[model samples]
Target: MRQTCVLLLFIVLTSCEYFNIKKTSPEAILKEELQTFNWNDVDEYPSFSECDSLTVKADKKVCFQQVLTTHISGFLQNEIIVVTKDISDTLVLNFQVSETGQLKLIDAKINALTKEEIPNIESLLYESLDSIPKIFPAIKRGQQVKTAFELPIIIKVN
Candidate 1:
């Protein structure tokens, strides 16, 4: 009888472990799903209306950037205030494209010195970005995804 009880306990303990091993807790499953997500890069960059014709990914990115730079530069040239001092600084524009393919300007920043000297830079950048039409969102794994970009514009004051 003692031997029978020992054998049954052993079977119960081993089977319990086996059953436990087969089942994943909700937390564990969530963690595993999250781990599979890639954050570094997307399969396709965001698309601009002007960039639709480009077949290559690199070309698309280049065309989109060129169009953006042109728009920003043109707007600045037309609307920017004339500063008396010779100024050279980099303006960083951080923006995002939503999954719904709408562009949102997150932030615009220049060097502290530039900010002090050129108060209009931020507003001009924001206004120019606002003028841009809807942009297609980035794609990853066959699904539209929100994507962010940091564009640095070199500004020189004459």
Candidate 2:
């Protein structure tokens, strides 16, 4: 009876380890869950209001980009700035689309020749983004997802 009880106890202990209920941290769990979707690729890109009616995916993509470019260009045109010296560089805009379809500007950087040339460039970029309408969030596997976008705008002062 003693031997039988010991065997039973061993079995119980081994079984518990076999069916180990691993306690995973919330961050670890989220990372594992997100692994199912490719972070670099989205099933559908975020769209602007003007792109809603486009049936073709390619057309929708182009339309969205065009509209975004137009809005940014218009905003830059409205901001009156005088360049004392000729400067040419690219301005990189980094932004994110929240899962709930909200546009958030992350960062804006200007490759300025001098600090005095565009001291308020970052704030100007933020104001320009603020003027934009709420963007539709990117879709991943038929579900809305938080996604990042990088837009490079060529700046030239002749």
Judging by lDDT against the true structure, name the best candidate: 1
**lDDT (10s digit) by residue, model 2, range 1-158:** 99999999999988877786878899998898888756788788889877999877788768767777778878977888787887777877787889987877787776647346877777777777877876888888899999888877776666
**Candidate 1 C-alpha lDDT tens digits along 58-134:** 88878877778788888888875777678888888888889998877798877887877778778788888878866
TM-score of each: 0.74, 0.70
Q: Note the Cα lDDT for every prediction shown.
A: 0.82, 0.79
lDDT of 1: 0.82
The candidate that achieves the highest TM-score relative to the unseen native structure: 1
Clashing pairs in 2: none
